[model samples]
Target: MRLDPPPTTPESEHRRRIGAVQEAMKREGFKLLIAYADCWRTANVRYFTDFRPVDGVHTIAQAVIALPAESDPTLFTGDGCLDYAASETAFDVAELEHLPLYLRRHLNADGRVALAGEEQIPVGLHRTIAEAIAPAPLVASNLLAKIKAVKSPWELEQLRHAAVLTDLGMEAVQQAVSTAGQVTERQLARAADVAMINAGADTPAYLSMVQAGPRSAFSLALPTNRVLERGDLVLTDIGARYGNYVADGGRGFVYGPPSGQAREIIDAAADAVEAGLAAARPGISAADLNGAIQAVLIERGYAEFSGEARGRGTGHGTGMDPEEELPWIGPTDHTVIEQGSVFTLKATINHPQVGGLRTERIVHLGATGLELLDTFPMRNFW
Candidate 1:
């Protein structure tokens, strides 16, 4: 069987994006905006130019896209390989040194400029750019986050495709857990990794979190060499990336039979997730959504496991980067739900007696309702 390569964002879409940002700059009184990209945080650059910098563990590769108010955007990078990788993108490619010269050619030093994805831009590089383009105010802004939060139809298609690949990965993980009898956490993680790549994912969205037994309580714990045992709950939170878009989710499975408390928690999480989806429509506040999910969990006698009591919010935004843009679904976030927003809703709980359990789903807020993107079964207490 053959898998299609991840679809590229169309040239027209890129132009549309540039035009929108240019309009935004005109409104904000800025002449140029520089969007930075590094190994992990590539959404700002990729949002504008569809070029993601290749990165490795501890490797410091970087790229930047310069979007002027009324000129063609340009791509600046460290070396030839980055240039080669960006050949098909709509921007003109150049070495990082050329940035100062390009800014000189494109805008006057007195022109107002801004930096997008400032956190992703290294301090030294920013100092150099500021020094080279002296007298131009370089303000930092999250303009891309504002613009990219609303999904273009092209982005939605890419996200939908990514979700399919994620479903494949999750399916493989569940199968390995059910049939492998006894396996190491790494074995289950590898099963998911191989399945997603074979199904056309650029990479696993994050290193698959395969925590067995009590270790499942720790969300940030990596897969260890310990073997999964029967009667233990195995928590698997994994997904795949497609064309830089992510499909992030997870589910819990029991290697053997689950205890009554385990079943109750799983059922409560499922109900809360459904309540979240029900509340996730245009015009609702992020707080409203959070409150709705919290209500469900509280109603189910898990009030201590609801909201901040459980250690994390109900969910966060998802897109080109897994944590792309945000209006966190928590008690305090007042960001309104808007049409075309893509995000995830998660129901999670951890107790000293019952261990940890979670279920996640990706969704896009359409004109009518939430378009559930993740099709993998929510195998509660599997």
Candidate 2:
């Protein structure tokens, strides 16, 4: 089910992640874990063994994790799936049913068994794991989140790759504006997509937001077939994923020139992003962070925020999954901002007539300085 990976590539990161798992197992007395996902987002599966499941599907590259208290971990996945991935990365993979009997035999003889990440845990599979590793604590420590929130050096490098791709994607939009006579919003998005994919990225990161004209003035917009005019404002937010980790980047653009409400909202949104970033130190609370930017947003002559959600929670947890775990850029986060937490602050301002202004920045809470995941811009692209 598994094969030794090449000397470079994925193996080194896999080994480092697994070594962390072994230490956690010893400290916590966790015997084994069963991590299953279509995506390689499951840190346990990736850490315990180098078996990234078929991304975006559950049955493809799935894994059944087995680890004794202090032993090198093992993984059971689809035949040839692990081997194929291992050719690119390093991991210890095997083929075995995740039945109760098989798990009991593979797990530690006598110790506690803990679930690594229960949020992503499947309902039916929880029963399977419970039946197999019974009589132990079966703890829900969210250990994976704790381990992954902090960035490793290699992960930081890969994040830069994702960011660089996003930068290239933004450039595509600029190119379209400079040369094109007329193009649909969807077409503009496609151009950016093509550029990002061709820029050493596995995919186009994600759909570049190309809401044009009046349609560009809101949150949660789906792309449509509206074409650009000589003086159309467009919002293009795009991102890329490297090694299953996401680095989201976005920007606002004007095919001609921005004025009136469009100009005000764009400036306000960029300032708000800056305010939020300024307040995101290790000791500051998420509430304080929101307050810093919320004050700026209110000062910019926009309507006051009036929702329980707390300012769109611009920052979210980042890792293999779409959301790593939590985004506490509001008052909800009681957890102290740790020294190494990776969070994406997507602060933006929106106006009814003008388009939305947004910026995506990945920040690592460091002792003295924060390492940016990407440094594109919140300015007008064209």
Candidate 3:
């Protein structure tokens, strides 16, 4: 059965987010905060204005939210997005080309300004904006990201809806792979995409990934035409996006009975994910959480395939973006896990003989403990 869409973030919540960012800017001596967003990285602008750009080949959708410490925020986009932005967001709308004029009105030469999403801002645009606010000393800041790290009640509901959609997609993949015979990886991936869209997702959070046999050894490989065979290990990573929030999850499967090595690797990854979840209470450092998961892998004699050895973290925060920066669960990251944060706990292993196996789930750190957002069977042998 299809799930209904979650409650949309009200205009008040958007205002509150803007206020929070303004407060942070005031503390940091930033007189104006300019947040840039493109089609890909939209959290910063969307957080303030709730307007997500619709990108296209001719229209490289981009948006900017200019928030002055003392004044209301303005949302700027191309003429193509003007109507949509006006309808979706409760902010003053302007043409993107007029950004310099708007900035000149709100910014003073001696005041300090900060730019969010600095890394993704185009060089030409950045130079133009810098010149527009000349002598204002626009500097890079992570204020928006830090503030958005913790999910609000409204955002959490969106994420939970997304998680349910993602679970349905993964379940579709599991069912497709379990069919009698000759199912190709591409077919399985299609099954998942169709299931999620039919179930009311804005879109699959990312390309549905289905890798079987030797192809599964590549962590981020796209689906191919390789047909599944008996004794071959299969891995599928899929997610669903709803209400601008997203859920990322994955599962492993064996076409036939699993080999002893395959079983061991999958079990180790599952155990590591469980350990990570168990240790995900508030007040614990992300490093501690990663250590808990890594410890399980090491004890299972799969240290070489652990995230540390592979240079990938055990897990990451998830929300508007599929992968948020804060609470990066890794060996050296020391960010403390806070209540109300949501994350994707994942453990992946690759073996030359058996292939790659990954177990992932979306979770939220509630007041009590980590709450599993996605609920699907972890072990599958078809």
**lDDT (tens digit, per residue) of candidate 2 on 1-382:** 1112112335666667667766876777666644444453555565444346765444454566665555666666666475665563443556545456667777554657767657666677778777777665577766656677777766666666776777777777788778888778887788778877776666654555778777766654767888777556676678765555566666776667667666666677777778778777868766676677667776766644212124556576665554566546665566666676777766565556555656667677777856676666676746
Tell me, what's the RMSD of every candidate?
2.4, 4.7, 1.7
Alpha-carbon RMSD, candidate 1:
2.4
| Clash count for each candidate, listed in order shown | 0, 5, 0
lDDT of 3 by residue, 182-204 (tens): 78999999998899889989898
Question: Order of candidates by lDDT, top first?
Answer: 3, 1, 2
Candidate 3: residue pairs that collide: none
Model 3 lDDT-worst window of ten? 303-312
TM-score of each model, in listed order? 0.92, 0.83, 0.95
User: Who wins the lDDT comparison?
Assistant: 3
CA lDDT, candidate 1, residue 128: 79
Please write out the lDDT profile of model 1 over residues 1-382, one tens digit for every residue: 3358976678888888899999999999999999888877788778766666776522237878888898888888776445564676766788877788887777786798889877777788899788867888898986767788888888898889888888898788878877886789889899999999888888898888888888876655789988977666677888889876888887877777888877777777778888898888888988889888877777787667544334357887888888765757787878787688898888876665666667888999888888999887665444
Residue 366 in model 3: shift from native, Å? 1.7
Model 3 TM-score, all chains together: 0.95
TM-score of 2: 0.83
